[model samples]
Target: MSQLTTHILDTSAGIPAPGIAVTLFVLQEKEWLQLAAGITNSDGRVNNLWEEGSSLPHGLYKLHFDTQEYFERNFTASFFPFVEIAFYINSHAHYHVPLLLSPFAYSTYRGS
Candidate 1:
């Protein structure tokens, strides 16, 4: 588990989107600094984005999901090469961001 976590569901296939690469970045003084990166597991979850119980500085953060490779792996044509979700982390509370994706479209939101 981590202070921040994520999962992806392939809405088109109705299954967990495994093997996708996900990256986390924190807004620095003037640029984005990489925080962590991980590949989704069989259940489409990345629970190690950061150390569990670690103190995460409150700031703007981003989650970049690699969609091109995932689409290519399944031989599907996709409109977006990748998906980036920017959010704010302002507290110690757990943050779960989940993505619902398909070949041509995607949606995401804060999750429990």
Candidate 2:
């Protein structure tokens, strides 16, 4: 498992948000460097954003969820074009960031 991971749950639809694009970035100097990107599977999880057992340096990181395309594909109007969550990783601990989403709203939190 990568040190970092994420999943999306479409609360409005009461199911996993499959096929959503998730991107990972690391802050280098003053730029956000693209680290990895993947589309969610049927379970809404991207488990291969990085090589299994890979460790990342402690720094600022961000996850971008492409919400607009997801909503468009399902023919649902959404409020936000996309969702960006910036977080800090201070150790090699596994980080699970999950998103709870709806058409007009979304929420995220640090997960186990």
State the C-alpha lDDT per candidate. Answer: 0.94, 0.93
Per-residue lDDT of candidate 1, residues 15-91 (tens digit): 99999999999999979999899999999999998998796899999999998999999999999999999999999
Backbone clashes per model, in order?
0, 0
Model 2 global lDDT (CA atoms, 0 to 1): 0.93
Q: What is the lDDT of residue 82 in candidate 1?
A: 94
Q: Which stretches of model 2 miss by more than 4 angstroms?
A: none
Model 2 lDDT at residue 9:
99
Candidate 2 C-alpha lDDT tens digits along 25-99: 999999999999999999999988877877988999999999999999999999998999999999989999999
- In the order shown, the candidates' Cα RMSDs to the true structure are 0.7, 0.7
